[model samples]
Target chain A: MSRKLLLWLPFALVFVLFAVFWLGLKNPDDRIIASNMVGKPLPEFSARAAMPDRPGVTSADFTDGKPRLLNVFASWCVPCVREVPVLLRMQQQGVEIVGVAVHDSSPALATFLAQNGNPYDRIGLDEGGRAQIEFGSSGVPETFVVDGKGRIVHQHIGVVTEQDVPQLLGMLGKAQ
Target chain B: MRRLAALALLIAAPLPAQAQDYAEVALPDPAQEAQASRLMDTIRCVVCQGQPISGSNADLAGDMRRIVRERIAAGDTPDEVRAWLISKYGDWVSFKPQVKPATLPLWLIPLVALVLGIWLVSRRLRRHH
Candidate 1:
């Protein structure tokens, strides 16, 4: 091969490798499957009240006889805000929804709830994120559907949507 | 000319160490800083492409670090803060994509590439022999 061709070959190989690496990395699906805690007992943890409208609501307040949906959220989380309408609709449909505000301040969370309208039956504040860790969450806006026995029957990661609720409800057997 | 070239090489050699030294010296709140650093390992710096913010020396990564620190200091929980970042930047900001339709390719492409690579290599070897 000519000297110029030989010099270009290494550069070409490097470019191909770079392209492959870029494509592989840019594709967002390359991730480990997070642990499926669905159909398993929900981990127990206590948190302070977070409801802006009702400051008295605590973790103890969530233990009613009905099935409950525990949603981990934060004021700063955009997806959590996106899913607010869905959760609000669920609340209207009489779903027992509990909110866990992970790693957020009372002021910011209060403002968020005030602006968005709170959809939770009771809200819990996980100030230090200890409670979130206990629940095996890596991030916020994760929803857990707890059965009457407090076992987690379903877990949904990322933002919840109107479309997702029907499937979630089906999993919980709350659907007709 | 040799002495001048030697000086240039020395200057280039210490550039990375100097940069590292700056980072080490500028350490802020150790606890929050460590958490921010850990977050960098897990979070893909969007502007820097595939590299984790922790591993990248990109300007975007530094900006992300600043953002992470700001959220943490403002009392956003780690998960909440991460989620916030992901939301603002898209799930692409996360080194590990949350399972979703848009991100299915991220999980499958690597395996597909691996299988194709192995198949091609095996076919080439077989033909060679």
Candidate 2:
């Protein structure tokens, strides 16, 4: 009876471990832990102008007494294209957006904006993608809410959906 | 045998280069390059969760490798680079998690489990004896 109980215990332990692993895998949201950039001043960066008609953006622009969204995007990132409608909605609602084009080639960006409608007021060309990394972004489609004082108030990882608009607006309010 | 040769050739070509991003650092310092390589192994590829930047081919991992090399070339010590990354991405980016209030339980729980496991086995052995 004791030997039987010991044998059962190993199986029970294995079953419990497998059950825990399966439970952990059920969560599909893959965003990493909250960004440490929140509440910190924006990292300094200067890039070539990606938008032909607009001045190139820089860290200093965030201090212009206007709360704005700084979006990191690229022609290669699919999720940035998906978030276009949400960005358009924000633009229509009077939100000023600064776009940073990672690994930018001006012609590709011009075509991308012409096809998707330009939502950016100031666009910077981060040709080496160094500025995006300085922003602590893992990939494109990452947005930062910057206050009038040049501090990063919030960070949104992955694609921003319609549902995320309300929280983004709320953060904008706080940025005010 | 031809299929086997093709398979081996496929493995021999381009695959290893993909595993190690060989974007030659223009800087003439081998020591900095070695330090950057070591530092890359200690940072997580944020988008790919469990894989370290050293072994991942994911785009973010490539970006991370570039950043590691650039910083090391720019004269930041490995500790400074680690601090900067941790400051931006939070503690989760480090392969070696720093000892902090939040991580104390994570370190202790494994030891606690091991002790409990040993205790259980010893109890079972005593019962058999």
Candidate 3:
């Protein structure tokens, strides 16, 4: 082989390999299309609630009585802020909305509620995110529909819209 | 070939030690820890720009970790924190950009270019043959 060709061969091989690897990697932003977890029992995990002028409350305190919507949110998350109005609307329609403040502070949460208007019946403070992982949440603005039996019926990732309400209600069997 | 072999060895040697260190950390609250880990996976490291803080070892990632802990501690709420970050850094701070008119091209350009490349190559091959 020509000397030029011999020197160029290794570079060409490396380039091709790099290109293949780069192309093969999946897109980072691809939607996480979850398998059916509907009709199945929810994961057993306890979460604390953000109490009024107090430390906070726990999942043990609010898991009983009625089926509820557990919304995992944070002040820093944009999508979560976008979904707040939708959640407020749900709360207006008598949807039992419980908040899980993941990795946030009490005063900041108090301020957030003061500014945004609190829609949650009970808010769980998962400051360290210990409770969040058990629920299999990868990020904030995750909503879970928990049945009266304390089983999670549905999980919504990203900003929830008004259009999602009927579907959420349908899962809860509250939709007309 | 020799250089490549040496590079591979260098890369492989550190990974086991790092993995061992990760495993050795005693996670008192596994659930909360997992949640923090998951959140890190979605949030882009400010300094790295392209990679998530979960995958990044940059000093900025550590700052982001502290920020995450603070937000969770302060009860700012996850959604609010994401909004704050986006407001501060723009949508690029998010590992996943929302699909919109502006971002559609980012998704479609690759496929369009692939098709064009194939067509051009086939045309050239036909002419050569």
Candidate 4:
């Protein structure tokens, strides 16, 4: 009986390997890079305004006992256009948004906000995407729920659609 | 002929801009440049996912390369730079995984399999003889 089981060992190993591979295929972890910056205090950096009228953003801005959503976007990004209405709705609900414009020009961002409607209280220009890296953001259209203490509570990659609005709001509420 | 010339101009227009990106800029010191180049190969291009930062042409990768070169030029050791990147991007950014408790199996499995194979082969050979 023991000898017979030993004969089947290679087959068992192969089956186990195949199962792991199949599970990976079923639910791929390909695109989601878990940010190390989550639960950490926001990196110390200040950014200039991406528009003429809006004020610049800084790390000190978040510690004023208010939890806000920090949105990383660019005028050139298409999904940011789709995300504007959802953000505006959130803004209307009394949620303050802090925007970081990575690799964007002031004129382009001004144009984008003019067409889509500006929802940000302050818009920071992240030259050369340095601030995005500090925030552990890989691409544009990422949202972070920053707590009153300036710690990043949650990171939402990709476009924040209507479906994600409630969850983000809930996270923000609990961030205190 | 006019359309062909216009197409050619369009294709050539973006080349210089790409060539002037951070990845193309090298550190003044040869030793520092070589160190930065090696570090780039180990770092993942977060935007491209599969390719290393050195091999990727994505804008983010170019910025990362520039940061690496700048940090090296500013007197940071290669390990320090790697640690800094890991702090920002997590261990996923490095191709070489550290041998920790969770990754111990990944490090030891091949050696264990090799020993097992050799033992099984020797045992089978002895039995056949």
Best by TM-score: 4
**Native-to-model Cα distance after best TM-score fit, residue A129 in candidate 2, in Å:** 2.2
Better of 2 and 4 by DockQ: 4
Q: For residues B18-81, write the lDDT of model 2, one tens digit per residue.
A: 5443443323467887888888889988878777888886766777777778778789999899
What is the overall TM-score of model 4 with all chains considered together? 0.84
Clash number for every model? 5, 0, 43, 0
lDDT of 4 by residue, B1-129 (tens): 999979977976766555444566776578999999999999999988879999998988988998898899889998999999899889999987867899999989999999988998999999999
TM-score of each: 0.49, 0.76, 0.50, 0.84
Chain A vs. true chain A, TM-score per candidate? Answer: 0.75, 0.81, 0.74, 0.86
Query: lDDT by residue for model 3 over A68-159, one digit each (tens)?
Result: 88788887666677788888988898887878887687778878877777888777677555555446555678888878776667788778
Pairs of residues clashing in candidate 1: A29-B106, A29-B107, A30-B106, A30-B107, A103-B77
Question: In model 1 chain A, where is the ten-residue run with the lowest total lDDT?
Answer: A28-37
Which rank order by lDDT, best down to worst? 4, 2, 1, 3
Model 1 CA lDDT for position A167? 87
Ordered list by DockQ, greatest first: 4, 2, 1, 3
Top candidate (lDDT): 4
lDDT of 3 at A76: 62
Model 4 lDDT per residue over A1-176, tens place: 99999989978998999999999879755677767999999999888987778899999999988999999999999989999999999999999999999988999998899999999999999987888989989998999999999999999999999999999999988988
What's candidate 3's i-RMS value?
A: 12.2
Better of 1 and 2 by TM-score: 2
lDDT of 3 by residue, B15-126 (tens): 6555322222322345655655666678876545567876776644555666665555456656666665564345666676667899999899779868966986798799
